[model samples]
Target: MDGWHDAADRFGVPRTDAVLLALNLYGLQTRLGARVRLQVSVPVGAQARTIVIAAGRPDSPFTLADSGQLFAGAELVGAAVRTDVDDAVSGYLRCWDGTAWRAATINPASRSKCTGCAPCPTSLEPTADPRLDTEDELHLLLDGLRQQLPHGGSLRDLHEITVSTACYESEDAALEAMMVLRKVLRSRRIDARIVLLSSVVRSREAFRWLAEHVGPFGLFLTADCVTRRNLILKKTKADLLPELMPALLADAREAGLDTSFTYIVGLDSTKDMEPFLSAMLPQVTLFPSLQVFQAHTPVMDGLHTPEADEFSYFLNARRIVESVMVDAANNLVPEPWRCYRSLWYESYAGQPLEGPRR
Candidate 1:
């Protein structure tokens, strides 16, 4: 309970109703053994609510104000959630979907062992260091996500699965990681859309190949992108990014993928905000997310601390992007925007996100 509130206070994200149910995912792959269950038994009058679960941490639980938005580790993969609606804390209960008894098990995940990237910052799901986890230990970790659980429900039952292993440092390593999951998912029935967060956008050829072979259905967030200031920081960065970003955004849209940029607020680049939005938002089905630059990152070195007004950033971005919407009058972010679950959208704008992007 203390972990919950401390993290929520730091990040300004909402706290989950966390109950430590005493079950642990102690070396989960060795046996089909551990399952932590939760009961949803409210009056039938409460039937209209949709339940959303947030991953609670036992320690060290925040990245700036991002909250659970930035955590990844082997233990996170071991975090399985079993919604035992019918059981209901040992009394008569009904499932939210009107079934007498229904249960589905899902899990969070960790990254592969390939994890170095200068541009990519660490978050919630961090893999063990390459030296510490032996090849065998690594294999066991992958099995947590690849292997099925001991019931009708599979680990893939997770709504918006985040795959955050260290394999995305290079193009080849990224491909290798995605291929392994592709192979596992080939014959399985999967309803979930896996969001692949990667830093290796080295070439359009590589991205195009991945999109074509992997059948990545549209949506890419160029996380390392900053506007004019980024180009000034390193000219090579200009060649690699700003130009390449919009090109890929256009390419992805042509191929039917929704693409958007990431704006780092408080950077010198925030000056580019209006023009950037005017140009980019029209191309995207989903608007770009403005992230408050924490100023702690290595890339942010030598820059003054951010004096960004987050509420203003959110408001301005919304106003510009809303023009592109057919329903321009709607104050809420449209349902299709994927990053809302983790972003402080509701905190700044006073509107709850419709749902997670899956």
Candidate 2:
């Protein structure tokens, strides 16, 4: 059979207008496993229909019949079959939200309760301005999250609440939002850690303020490249990070907060990150930590497509960081392993810190 063929007949759509997209077999080792989620996206005419088939390991020569219906109680739910031919299948999911079909998901395992609209942990992408949101906006959004949680889930039940401010008006505004959000979560008795994104720590003051208010929050710092030229290309300031990050790390250690760093590889160029890593890793070790690694992805707009060389850069960077940390740990120095987040918690917080929830 063809890798992709017309699905008009099987799905009851017009043959001339419908096409069967790839049947993505996920969680498969070599063949179908004991459990797998089959995500099929078929475009009929101008619209599309996606069916998520959940099932156990199927018989050889896999067929849809082996997969059971996607159930919402006794009623099976899915999108309508379109009649037009579209070449590409957009992976967005559709579900009946009581009244009409809307984009949804089957992941998070909690989304099984999706009744129509998008699920909780609702996205709050910041705008070009901070005042773009009213004071009550965030509280309302949190209320919505509480309402959307699967019947028995509570705010405390969540693992972590990640807030990314990649496009905020200013650092102060982002800081204010973080402070307010911390308060909102605290009032609800939700103990989930709040993971703030890059912009929240744009300056030493902002970083210090964040550490003071949101102590123990996670920092998701994404620096794709450390070179000056690439930093300019990415519209990131050169002096700010170099001067602020180390200082901020020191401050965080003193204040008993945790931070993590992510470096993206293969942006403007692929080369040795050793010099950069060597200079910074020691400073990073001076403070408590979560994670540090080089990640490369093709979906990033201006970055080069990650090829073999890019992969090499990523692997080499990881190897060097791990080796350095290992060497430090093996030495007979007094504070050999006190730089990790867990160490700080063990010494200061009076208890071992648990890993951040997913």
- For each candidate, the alpha-carbon lDDT, in order, equals 0.37, 0.36
lDDT at residue 95 of model 1 (Cα atoms): 20
By TM-score, the best candidate is 1
Q: Where is model 2 more than 4 Å wrong at Cα?
A: 1-132, 200-204, 228-244, 268-272, 282-302, 305-311, 328-358
lDDT of 2 at 53: 19
RMSD of 2: 16.1
In model 1, where do residues sit more than 4 Å from their true spots? 1-152, 156-160, 164-167, 202-208, 227-239, 256-258, 285-289, 295-314, 323-344, 347-352, 356-358
- The sequence of per-residue lDDT tens digits that candidate 1 reaches over residues 1-358 is 3543454445444433111110110111211111212222122121122222222222223211112111222223112222321111111111212211222211112332322333222332223333212334434443543443334534444433334332444568656655555444454544344445444544566557656666543344444445444533323334455444555667666764445555554443445555555555555655555443432233433343243323233333444455544333333354422331123322333345443221
Distance from true location, Cα of 310 in model 2, Å = 5.6
